[model samples]
Target: MKQPTLPFWQVWNVSFGFLGVQLGFALQNANVSRVLSDLGADLHSLSLFWLAAPVMGLLVQPIVGAASDRTWNRLGRRKPFILGGAIAAALGMFLMPNASIFVAFLAPMIFGGMMLALMDGAFNVTMQPFRALVSDMVPNEQRTLGYSIQALLINIGAVIGSILPFVFTNVIGLDNTAPKGEVAQTVTWAFYVGGTALLGTVLWTCFRTKEYSPDDYNRYKNIAPKIVEKLSLTTKLANFWKLFINMPKTMRQLALVQFFSWFSLFIMWVYTGPAITQYIWGVEAKWFDAEFLHSVDVIPADIAAAKGAAGDWVGITFAAYSLFAAIFSVFIARIANRFGRKITYSLSLLAGGIGYISFMLFQNAEVVHVNLLLTEIDIPQGALNLLLPMVGVGIAWAAILAMPYAILSGSLPADKTGVYMGIFNFTIAAPQIVSGLVAGQILKYAFDNQAIYIIALAGVSMILGAIAVYFVQDNSDSTPDERAIQGH
Candidate 1:
């Protein structure tokens, strides 16, 4: 039996949770480094601290996915995982920045790291199921549209989350700085708002959307299992390895591109805070580093001011990119229809690469003079440089979130969709892990401790990803049954 196609609003209802989830994620993404730095983490160890997120994602997603597959309760198949993850994530968001206040026994950085891991793991739990849910409900023909809706919502949330700190500091007159080791009032309030949004949106989806029963889902997929054998933990672990060994050619090809894409993104996320602090603000942020703070003679007041400025600009940059992503998402479907998905995605990535590269052009303390409509406006070259690149990042981000999964959805077995989506997360997680491990060392030795160079590396990596996409065989045009057997 053909799965009934959902109307746009129904699709909207099901995917709307991503908005809040991504809001929580975006807030974390944009501000975690700032929070950690404020709590006294070193630039060299920043990536190591961020390792918590990807490591948790690597372990959590597949387990959550497999569990959701076999689960059947009054709450529905995927909704339980979704709701559970959201609740944990909400708690995590609230605790992450405020770890110093809440978990005062542990060092602020250590406590924040634990909360980061918790939040990231919970996000993976929520994220994997939602991706699989889209595949489960939307027919192959509408998969792109469904995922695009998700992309659109994700960007929308990101925009709000990324801008919150800036808004709080600038608009609402919240304090963006705190005493030596506490988080800023701006960050604390942002996390509180983000946590609330995350839970509320997820609850809306849980109440508004319904899922096919497990047996009914199997029937719809045209898979008839003679036995309902329960899977043991041992069996599940073995199956994950088996699935990895037997991954489809398309997935293998996409994996290469995903590696480069996420590696660059990981670098950006890890280094951007320090880069802005050091390069744009013209202040060393080493007061957060215990060793450096003890060894060097620097005033605490200067260090706090620099960190605050960097955090505010980073928030603004993220907001700019998210805004661009949301705006670009409006027309992405139309563009993809006119041009092939591969071409569109590749071009979008290439644009982002150029945008990232532009950052290198600005000199420290240089003013960017803009002449718009006979008005002369002077913007900091460092901050203005980020805005244009965000357009490209935004475009590429929209495609990255939607295109790969939309192609893979048809090729996956219907009953195993959750597992495969969980498995696919390995690609995203592995790159981040690899980058996290090596990024600090690379910056220390190769880049001469210059954080800005990491963005350059990210730009090149994105360009490489754009080239890699053409090699993948897009299976978006094929039906599930037709493509499922073909890939295997």
Candidate 2:
């Protein structure tokens, strides 16, 4: 019943779809707010508009997970769901940046919200299966390596997706500005390229890898199969609730860690655009007309330029973090080996917390020096300041994507991997729901509309998360090298 160690290339092939999946996610994270703002959503109302993503993830992921667990087909179980979700997500991404065109007759908010929901739902549908597949195929000892590979591919895709808008406008001569009530050409083209990457990479994984059949799974679990019948809708709902109420001890502990981790990220994703624009670029909502939400024209040329520049900087910050994530992912297993997963993950989160706190020093200053490879490059202080925090965020992100699953997958019942994994999504989606509901209100009232304060709050939340992670009981097994030395 032992699962054989897959060759390194095979392991990479199994998780490769994440690269494409993350391209869609990176595009959404880096650009969605800017698109909403371009369509004239007020800062106070922005979080409400962003609610569609978590709401959809909450509704979709568990259902897809439960269904996939019971599914079987010629094309294989997880592959079908992955392919379907990728297609739907790619379509949503393609339509997202073009939402302003619908404003001729329909409200831009309504169309844009629909596309966001569609993209989120599709992404969740694919994501759960990808996580479960790694659990399904990889043994406990290799879980960190398998998941970290996915994390590496994720950041690589993120770097490309995050930098696309910046590259389009600054390097390729795309107009970053549109007349009032329209998305910029740079963002529009970025979405186009992201959509293509989403579909293409997912297709690559689908064609190159094959999933274990249900019969093979039954053999692995030492169970005999009778004639299988599909569950009724009522039973699926009952099982979903039952699984929630009876989560394992490890899942319960990891839930606390995931709560703060995702909450801090939700805040960053929502406020980073406004924070940079208002704090760094000195652009305010008052400088432009909100009436442009309904009709075009009368936005000052200078204000539009400032907003465009701020959006590009946000893209650069995202790319910097993704770059760091890619660099750190390769070393995560080695670091985890020396420190153990708990201390390693906790330290990463602590570093990210300090990084977020560093935002407070980002005054509208002049030149900043960055030392890299024995050379010092001088750049604008705002740009240099933002890049420094990403180092910690990237390290924490690598752990976030790998460690919890590496722990929880070992404890889960093999027969119910899909359902339990689906339940894990609650830890991620619920926090975003909480943050989406309250983050904007906190920014407006608590800090007097100072968005930079939200990043500081995120830093505190991450530090608290590091503390929570320190107490979780790790059940991961030792690697083959260690086992052989022990004569196992």
Candidate 1 residue-wise lDDT, 227-332, digit = tens: 7677897996788899878977778888988988899888877777777777776775445456775464444675676678678778778877888888887788
* TM value for model 1: 0.93
Clashing pairs in 1: none
Error of 2 at 71 (Å): 1.1
What are the per-model numbers of colliding residue pairs?
0, 0
Q: TM-score of predicted model 2?
A: 0.93
Error of 1 at 15 (Å): 0.5
Compute the lDDT for candidate 1.
0.82
Off by over 4 Å in 2: 221-227, 285-297, 367-379, 478-488
Off by over 4 Å in 1: 102-104, 285-288, 295-302, 364-379, 478-488
- Cα displacement (angstroms), candidate 1, residue 379, comes to 6.2
**What is the Cα-based lDDT of residue 450 in candidate 2?**
77
The window of 10 residues in a row where model 2 has the poorest summed lDDT is 479-488
